[model samples]
Target: MKFKIEFSGHENIRSNHQKTIEITKESHLTPQGDCIVGVNANHACADLPQDLKEKLKNPDSKITFSIDVGEHNFTIEGKGHPDLILTHDEDIVIRKSDFVCPRTLAVKCDKASDLLPREMVSMLQDPKTKGTFTITVD
Candidate 1:
């Protein structure tokens, strides 16, 4: 599938930087049954506040990111997983929670149950839904 993640606004929560960045999705799904998407953080690292990046690396962080698919906006929040890592190529890890039923879909994210609505996850499970999606970071 082909998709783009748009990062706009200033670096930190507050800044006047007018830079906007777009990163393409490398692939989906991880070895441990998770949905993985990443972009080189360096592309917009200069605009981002240092603290936000630190928070992203912290397992206890409560930061939430949004993924917009057509009119539906699904959310993915931070999971305090020890394996979760945020570096130059920021990998957004979506894990399957206990709420998700067993499935054969390769597009499912393990951490997504708590982050995304069940119905949205169901829609994504459909192979027809693959192709283009957007991750908006503001």
Candidate 2:
């Protein structure tokens, strides 16, 4: 199953969080929200397709996220846990740990915000930058 989200960059994006990466529907961000790489998201965690969400609740499912910003592309791989509720109204978060929450998309991710290329992070600091993220379960 698959789901997709479109979002844009924010001026305050730091992409410095060590354990997670996030995208949110909120229009603004503070430097403290270092995990948030994109804002003004078109779809939140709760907006994921039912089939996709269903797969996300299976502990044996592996998930892949394709991150695209301008011409740059990146991939993040993680596992879905049975604890996933996929009910957050405004955010989609991918974590490098086992922590589960309403906002969590996938846990034990192979990459966190801090692991993204600095050049890509720099480009994402511009509010004019747009991004597309696709999530797939296989």
lDDT of 2 at 28: 81
* Cα lDDT of model 1 by residue, 8-96, tens digit: 21111111112111222233333233232222222322233445444433445444445554456655443333333333243333333
- Model 2 C-alpha lDDT per residue in residues 1-138, reported as the tens digit of each score: 767799998889999899999999999899999999999999998988888888988888989998899889889999999899889999999999999999999999999999888788888999999999899899
Instruction: Return the TM-score for each candidate structure.
Output: 0.36, 0.97
Regions of candidate 2 where Cα sits further than 4 Å from its true position? none
Best by TM-score: 2
